[model samples]
Target: MQAPGGAILEGFIDLLVEDGDGLRVVDYKTDQVALKEVDERFAGYRLQGAAYALLAAGVTGRPVTRVDFVFTDSGEVRSLAGAELAVQVAEIRTRLERAPGEEPSGGGDDQLRLPGLNGS
Candidate 1:
């Protein structure tokens, strides 16, 4: 997938479900956390969910009405929708568009790193 700024965003989503409401992006998490604290523990995953939602929407040509993080360890699901999901996606996009020579944080094996940025 490609972001609006022409940056390549590639990933494999765990699941993508389509229904009358539109597309739903689902990402599986194996993190072990208490059910009551799942939301707080996995809050950082919102960006990942948002990215999947955007990619799924782009490929399917449908609106992504929901993004879900299914916690396998606790059998809990955290969902983001409406304006919250939109804001997350927008924030992620803004972080992705780095100026020349600017280094992006969270550069790791799992995260997508843009080439030619910060000497990468």
Candidate 2:
């Protein structure tokens, strides 16, 4: 997908399921955080989910209503939808537009990096 700054971003989503509402993106994680720690762990995964949501929506031309982050090690499920998802997507787009070091923090994307995602 094309970011706000005209950088192309691409990645594979773990899973996609369509229901009455719309498409849902599910990403499996091994963070090993317990259910009680979900809130903390969930924050770090939001932008990744948002990116998946945007890509899925663009590719299928369907609204992405939800994103699910499943913590395999802890058997926990965290979800992002509605307003929260929108906020994260917007935040990620803002980061995508900025040049590498310009991102305030969590700017290291060693997990999955797109060549021009930092608007190179």
Q: For this target, which candidate reaches the highest lDDT against the unseen true structure? A: 2
lDDT string for model 2 (20-100, tens) is 779998888865677788777788777878877877887889989999988898888889999999998787777777774
Give candidate 2's error at residue 94 in angstroms. 1.9
lDDT of 2 at 25: 89
lDDT of model number 2:
0.74
**4-90: candidate 1 lDDT, tens digit per residue:** 665666667888888568988878877687888887766777777777777788888899999888889989988989999999888
lDDT against the true structure, each candidate: 0.73, 0.74
Q: Which residue pairs in model 2 clash with each other? A: none
TM-score of 2: 0.80
| Backbone clashes, candidate 1 | 0
Q: After superposition, how far is residue 89 of candidate 1 from its true place, in Å?
A: 1.1
| Candidate 2 deviant stretches above 4 angstroms | 99-111, 118-120
